[model samples]
Target: MAWGESGELFAINGDDLLTLSLEDQTVETRASDLKKDSPQHLPFSGANILFDIAVGPDGTAFVAYYGNRQLLAVSPAGVVSVLVQSESPWSPHGVDVWGDYVYFLESTVGGRPRWKFWGKDRIAPRVRRVSVGTSTLETIYDGL
Candidate 1:
């Protein structure tokens, strides 16, 4: 769970994104029904597993969608939108917001089902960040 700068606490429960109030202790749904039904265009199949959430300065939550290999933004009013999506085989995870960028971790594999225990050295993990309002990604660290 992560506490937003705007006093809201964010967490991922199953496929749902939940926000909680510290003062009133109220819980609200930010997003839900995150699972995918059919394999259409994206590299992965099955349900969308939300990995991590980062609350932006404007109180919007930037979520790392592992199954879809994309970043999603949840507004303060609970509107969900895709921030960016990668056509590659990487799956995004571990998100945080700092300064002008939203930093996250990406696995070389697409999803958990496709993951293997050995021969993973060739599949390098990366620490990447994207500028707000742009889909352009910048690598902070690679081969980690």
Candidate 2:
């Protein structure tokens, strides 16, 4: 869950995006079944794994899907669009935004069973930045 620039709170509930109503303690579904709306097949078997969420200043919500290796943008009207989809071995995690770039940890560790990598070194962890405006992705740091 993450707070938007306008102080609106957003959260993912079982692969669905919901906006929390703090004033009345209500929740509104912004988007549902994200995997069904994805542009490409999300390479995963069980439930969808939504890693992180970040909201931009313009009220666009960013959702990081570990299983799909894609970062999608949900507009205020709940229009879903693929912002950046990594080719392979690079899934977006810990998504956040500052200035014009959305920052995240791009790693291959995602989609792997947690027990296998528990208490072990991550595989090729990287820091990446994507332009929120142009949707251009760039590697800020790679490897150790």
Candidate 3:
């Protein structure tokens, strides 16, 4: 859950990416399962398992999904659409939006553990950033 404009609390349910309006205490889903009827060849199978949601500076909400690794933008009028999707596994845990950029944490397979049973070497993690109005995604940091 995070704060929206005017300091209103917005909660995102983990199951269906529902955005609840705490101001009026009403439950409303931001995205729908429109891709459920799509063929298997399609990337989004309509199974939306949301992980995190971040409100941009303009009050637009950005939601990340774990099922399809897709990011969506929700407007104040309740329109939802895909923002970006590629080969990257965007298992976003947390999200924040800055000026013209949306920053988030994406889980990548760093490497296999050195030890099998009691591994001590921690594999480095990666951070990803996507432009708000562009399709380019760049890795800001790695080996974390």
Candidate 4:
């Protein structure tokens, strides 16, 4: 979640988007349930699992969804719209706004197993970046 103009808190549920009034602690729906009816299939399949949000210079809030690598833009009026979609199974985990760019991190794996018997890395396997306005994506970094 992130703060909007004047410190208004906003959150994305991956299924429904919402905004909160910090003064009164009121909750409002920004975007309702989104249905993916696309016939063209993708490797990833699931509702949005929004993990982080960042407000841009224009006061627009961008939400990063970990499940489908979907980024959503929330307008001042609480309207949520699709900003970008990863071409593969990349999971978005964190987000922040840097000047004219909305920067975010996408991971290849969700999380690491706790026990040694699982034999999994205790962190995300990989990450990438994308330009907010232009929708240009690039692999900035990666690791196991």
| Top candidate by lDDT | 2
After superposition, the stretches of candidate 4 with alpha carbons farther than 4 Å from their true spots are 34-48, 110-125
How well is each residue in 7-124 modelled by candidate 3, as lDDT tens digits?
Answer: 5455665444455666688776655552333322232344345667888866778776555656667776667777766354334545778788888765533454522222453333
Give lDDT tens digits, candidate 1, residues 28-130.
9888865455534354455357778899898889888877878888888888887877557667878999888988887775234443534553345778888
**Overall local distance difference test of candidate 4:** 0.64
- Which residue runs of candidate 1 sit more than 4 Å off their true CA positions? 39-47, 110-123
Q: Regarding lDDT, does 1 or 4 come out ahead? A: 1
TM-score winner among the candidates?
2
Error of 4 at 104 (Å): 1.4
Each model's lDDT? 0.76, 0.78, 0.60, 0.64
Clashing pairs in 2: none
Off by over 4 Å in 3: 14-27, 34-48, 88-90, 113-124
Going through the candidates in the order shown, the clash numbers are: 0, 0, 0, 1
In what order do the candidates fall by TM-score, top score first?
2, 1, 4, 3
In candidate 1, the residue pairs with backbone N, CA or C atoms under 3 Å apart (3 or more residues apart, or in different chains) clash, namely none
Error of 4 at 101 (Å): 1.2
Supply candidate 3's per-residue lDDT for 66.
50
Decoy 4 TM-score against native: 0.68
Give the RMSD in angstroms, all C-alphas superposed, for model 2: 3.7
Residue 112 of candidate 2: its Cα lDDT? 44
